[model samples]
Target: MGVHPKESTAQNIENIKRQIGEIAAIYDWDMEVNTTDPEFYKWTQWIFVQMFKKGLAYEKQMPINWCPSCKTGLANEEVVNGKCERCGADVTKKNLRQWMLKITENTDRLLGDLDKLDWPEKFKKMQAEWIGKNHGAEVDFKLEDRDEAITVYTTRPDTLHAATFMVLAPQHKLAAELATDETYHCPKKTMVYTPSLIWKFI
Candidate 1:
């Protein structure tokens, strides 16, 4: 339905624009907006700067779909069946600096106001899901051999006694620092080690 701007010829671009104009005429649209306009993106950058100044945006390291061929990170939807949808390259988890919004700070007020809106029951439920608030307790566990403490969020804190092992993300410093070996000689009871990058500590 659309011709990619980067790869498309001038004729392709003109054809698509003509099709869109025909569609717009059917709806009697006042104007058509071109998303490739740099001026429009400047407004978005200004909005982000405002959010950053308000402490609503911050950078954090997070795992994302990485394409080796593209040498870039792809969104979750951009990865199809563990491969990059664009280049068909195998997608892997790579930690990259990502901007995060502190929308959770207003989740309470947002959820509270949803009930006051005149909407359908299912629509209100959808709004609640969009807010995505979770009631959980952040239990802090102290490391037995170190002065470090790990905090975990759980909706069921009562079953914490069964939490014999903790699964640390691949980006965790302990995953790289503490890993010495991978082979475990359980039968001979000689070697015991954590996984290479995915640490499953007991």
Candidate 2:
């Protein structure tokens, strides 16, 4: 009983509503709410429009966790082990135009306001941990043959001089650029580089 973005069209919504109605009637349940209903979604759309007007919502092209099977982008919390949490399908990074809400803009306010809530201590602690406030400086490392520099954020900038090796995620844009050997490049665009080669360059 799930409706994905692709199946949220007028015709498909009507079909889903009819199906749900039949099921509710058989069960004799008070199913007064239908999210697919235009009357309901219009308010949701209005709220989004208002947010956009206030500069709280914006559209940008960025790397996102994409579920190929579902044909939709997912949030960071919706992805598990590089897979879609809903469909259990392998998720890949895709640069797509997406609507982003400026939640970070209210981070400090939200964190301070949490003190007013009557929540359990453990729950409050978890929420605070999730917010993850940290003071750090971004230091750039120059690449050997490239004009580009890789920036690393660290809380302890003093220890950065002693750092010998650096690791980048397989999907990182620089991982492919830094890979010199043909074996490191794959048809699926997954980059793999040797530690020795990376150390030699850096």
Candidate 3:
């Protein structure tokens, strides 16, 4: 995301070098800045190329919640008190192309190493909470009109006898249409309709 505009080059490059030095100092690492050095840019470019080679970097269009006035997408962790951080405007969902880090592909190995870290009890608990590990079977629901089935992950398969209702994710493509079906008894107003489906399974 860092780029040096040629017109603003000299001043911006010096500022970047200064910030890098400050960050290194805070981390107790010794480093020096040589802004006029071509080696620096070469290293940066090589890092970028390595990332692309590993298929870790790519661009795509993603639907996101954004505030037009602020011109930035709101991350799930960024929404606070129902206001935009940059412009104080109400955020709205929009379809736009955006870049995302592929952390899902690395989730398993990351979680497996959690116990190896020496950390405070509270922080370890938070880490476990963030991982939210659950072991369960994949169950499929047959759609009425479609030949295909929708699969949902449930950690409580042993409690199948008490199935009371079902809930589907709002982002699920079939949710809106499924909500109106007579056989399924989909509740009209809520996004977290899992309990509705779970009830039926009971």
Candidate 4:
């Protein structure tokens, strides 16, 4: 049976459970639980509630990676080069209200405790890079004919004077603003061009 938007969620869940059961039986694997079951999700909900009560979980409005094909919000780790890691679809930036977990608060402790783990050197290095914390200066660029300014973070503040052109990522929140101006036109054929070539006014 094909799983489509028209299919009921209950039917899809049942289909998944059946397929997993068949695979488990063929592989002689012992599958004790189905996370889709109500009992399992109850505990998951309880944990989220506990985290919210402890202030570790909170909601905020922010820019997030969105997969248009999947129609869902994705985490930073789930996006690679402005594409969805799971579906390989082009991802875009979307501003929406989302729940956020304050994991950065433990960045220092997490980095320091990494050495104590038995993981390989490569794995440790990757974790350290993922927890990337760096000091940078926030520079604001005034928009042409617009009162708003875009703020960018850069480690090399001295090199700002030599910058001749501004390139914003396709998934940037401000990229959509370029379309509002009639003078700035991006050709549809050059959509895949690197840097997206939004506005060329120099």
Write down the lDDT of every candidate, Cα atoms only. Answer: 0.71, 0.73, 0.63, 0.74
Better of 2 and 3 by lDDT: 2
What would the per-residue lDDT of candidate 1 be over residues 1-202, giving only the tens digit for each residue?
Answer: 4867645655666787789887874634446454456766788889899999999999998777778789998988998877789989777666778899888988999999988999999999998998889888998877657787667789999998876666665445555565545521122221112233333434
What are the TM-scores, per candidate, against the unseen true structure? 0.72, 0.60, 0.53, 0.57
Output the number of the lDDT-best candidate: 4
- C-alpha lDDT (0 to 100) for residue 10 of candidate 4: 64
What's the lDDT of the predicted structure labeled candidate 2? 0.73
lDDT of 4 by residue, 19-98 (tens): 98878745333555656668888998999998899898999877777788899999999988777899998877666887
Deviation from native of the Cα of residue 194 in model 3, angstroms: 18
Minimum summed lDDT over a 10-residue window in model 2 is located at 188-197
What overall lDDT, based on C-alpha atoms, would model 3 receive against the true structure?
A: 0.63
lDDT of 3 by residue, 1-202 (tens): 3655553677776687689877874533347555556777888778767777778667776557677678888886666655676677766555566555455556677777877889887897898778666678888867656786777677887876666556654445555565553434434432233222321332
User: In terms of TM-score, which candidate is stronger, 2 or 3?
Assistant: 2
Candidate ranking (TM-score, best to worst):
1, 2, 4, 3
Candidate 3 Cα deviation (angstroms), residue 6: 9.6
Candidate 2 is scored at a TM of: 0.60
Which is the better candidate, 2 or 4, if ranked by lDDT?
4
lDDT of 2 by residue, 67-157 (tens): 8889998999999877789999877777667799887777798789889999998988899888877778999888777798878789999
* Separate clash counts for every candidate: 0, 0, 19, 0
